[model samples]
Target: MSGAAPMRVLANATELIELLAGEGALPLVDVATRIGVPRPSIYRLCEGLAAVGMVELLPDSRVRLSTRWLALADAARAGMLEWRGAPEVLAHLVERTGQTAYLSVPYGSSALCVDWCQGRAIDVLAYRPGSMMPLHVGAAGRTFAAYGVPLPEGDRRRRTEKTIIDYDELAADRERIRRDGYALSEEDVTIGIGAVGVPILAPDGTLRGALSLGGLVEDIRKHCDEFVAELRAGVERLSGV
Candidate 1:
């Protein structure tokens, strides 16, 4: 019973970290309410996390993740040996396309953004490092699915009216991506935003990851072919790594 109790606390701590990562700083009470845990338990968890440098308690009674997590995230990114050259590739893509570039890998039924380079244009708040997008929702996720990663089963959330939530439509979309050798998402994840992505595949055709570019809907639509060219070139550079 003693051992089990500590494990439960650890699990709760993980949930707390995830919540902080997604929602940013929040008061202890709000955290408890959102996490469905008691106030006393959450307070203890925050203190324990703070002691370990995983999170910090603000002067205003809000709790936020510590900067130490940045180093840990960097270390995790470095550990993916296959993506060693991803940063440079993303940078090059951003330079050529003038759109935000991202490197993502399949995480279960989601595409996890591990690295990104912001472009000179508008900022895309839909995804960032350490964020995950469902395989049916975004260009990167769709690229993963078209290239062999399994699409998640069950009802998919519709982020916008353009999001393909129907199974048949999603299946057809995947087919189009496969046939075209790239995935294109127009206002699917975020309204007024668009993205194009291609799979980073191993020599035997196994998916290694996804390379994508995103920007305003108009810019993405007008320059899609050019963006796809640059993205494909970047993926080629990554393939050599």
Candidate 2:
């Protein structure tokens, strides 16, 4: 094959991988439709990926991630040591606030929970590690959307009836979060739950992740100011380290 042809094929494969990572699973027809490629082209790409163990074809003909990708992710994490300080940070947050603390990053149209530390209380099981959460509803999600990542396109239709839903209202709140250096939600995403979030910025001043504390709305309300202050302090401490 010519050099240009090989480069084109590589680009196509990369795009296919991104789509699979974003959507989790896709059928050949759906992939073709979304990528605007011909069905045969998508089939050939999937076949090549499956052959290399980068993807898998399920019994129902749907395609999803393969173990090879997980291996690669593990290797990358081990190299980067992304979680080197995460455990201690989480423990400190949970101990300081007596509430569940979580770290989340933007993942496609959602926020992916990377790690969590639960308080001594038994009610801290709402958010599970590796869960994908809506970016338009929760405190952490709103902080992410306000910082750079846009809210999910479809969230406008499924407005959060429990809290703020108007796009303009949310946009205004985003401005406040930017100014305040923190974000708060009270019975907004999940009923009876309140949360405070602070953006995690990289040394280059780019948003890298978010840290949040969760608790019962009433309890959070009673101590909202103190909690926000503490959470902000913790984020600042983490940033300096």
Candidate 3:
């Protein structure tokens, strides 16, 4: 809308990607026709992206995702530290809590899961790597809120019956977590699933991400304190890294 050039550029880039995903590469004219933009604009977009290593422009006047993207993907994969004992820790967390365990880091305005493990008794496992949940509807979000992540006003809406809709109420909850060093969520994202979330603090005391355990509400309530202790220990152990 309006003259938001950056937004328009981003939209054109995503549309071009979707087209290329299904149709491979095409010249500026075909790409502009499919995306309903001017050919000159598409050409400029492609050139800009190609300069930044996002696309490769061929002598045949076609374009495709650059081979360099593989290095970027590898870097992102390494960023998760999945190869460096994270999965084992999550598996152990599941065993100790008898609930699904998650490691969610803040990505933009959402909690982005990088790893998880399903517990033995868990019949429902919903989260996985690349899954993103908004910053207002889960234990991970509550952890971000407690640490002053600055969620937008729109995310304060209802996603479930137990989702906190009022900013004042959510503020009080965040305040409690900031004081208590953890957050508990009950039936906020999915009904009947309760969770406890704790922050894995960095050496500088910055919030890295959240580690959470989720399962049936009854079981979660029965072992919440133990789960909290275990989660805190996990954070402390990670902090030594």
Candidate 4:
């Protein structure tokens, strides 16, 4: 019958979970500010969530929704009768471009390739699903990193003669990617492969992953403008879906 009891009832674990999940990744201060709760209370709630594997604390102390959510997503994808259409999207892109197309999601300090479609043209370098790329390298990794994901410390130490390794330089590149809506890497990872990458964002604006195209630098150079246009168009179509 008391208002105090009603207030307590409104602040259940479910409410906390819903808040964190809806907000995607958030710092303690931002979460506290958004939820109108004190930092200590938010930290305690995050600790509880982290204990249960629903949330994870990043190295920088930011709290993020965990991979456990992917289980439910995978389950849903398994049940959907029309879900078989997913591969065709990547297939269509590869078919059109005649280059390796890849979809990757950020995992820990790397980007994990979750899906790929290889072109008919043979290439010395090929990537398969589950292959991991360092977050500081390649177009897919750079796309994810550009959207505020932390790059691994060790990766920063290994500087490609042509690549940006300094934090400030990397930060500037990230800002450029954010503004340009795609990432371009020429021999940043492999000597012969050039990559073009676009970030895939969720409806709520959180970074879901990145879609990338990899091909020989000479081939890509011949169609550089067209390749970027097609890559951006493909990502736009996927984002709508």
Judging by lDDT against the true structure, name the best candidate. Answer: 1
For each of the candidates, the C-alpha root-mean-square deviation to the true structure, in angstroms, is 2.9, 4.2, 7.8, 10.2
lDDT of 2 at 110: 72
The reply for model 1, stretches above 4 Å from the true place, is 2-8, 25-43, 57-63
Model 2 off-target regions past 4 Å? 1-12, 81-83, 105-114, 118-137, 148-167, 185-194, 202-206, 214-226
Per model, how many backbone clashes are there? 0, 0, 0, 0
By TM-score: ranked, best first: 1, 3, 2, 4
Give the alpha carbon lDDT tens digit for every residue of 34-107 in model 2.
77778888889899999989999888878887868766765654564555576678888888889888878787
Native-to-model Cα distance after best TM-score fit, residue 177 in candidate 4, in Å: 0.9
Structural similarity to truth (TM-score) of each candidate:
0.83, 0.70, 0.70, 0.62
Task: Provide the overall lDDT of each model, using Cα atoms, as 2-decimal numbers.
Answer: 0.89, 0.77, 0.79, 0.74
Candidate 3 per-residue C-alpha lDDT over 1-241 given as tens digits, one digit per residue, 9 for 90 to 100: 5689889899999878656643467876788887899888989999999999888899998988777755765577577653355676788888777788888888767787777788888667455555667777778888997897878887365767899878898889999989988888888878888888898777788878988888888888888889999988777655554
For 112-204, candidate 1 gives per-residue lDDT tens digits of 899999988997558899888889888999999888888878748788999998899988998999999989999998999999998888888
Cα TM-score of candidate 3:
0.70
Q: Candidate 4, residue 234: CA error in Å?
A: 2.1
Better of 1 and 2 by TM-score: 1
Candidate 3 displacement at residue 4 in angstroms = 8.7
Clashing residue pairs, backbone N/CA/C < 3 A, model 2: none
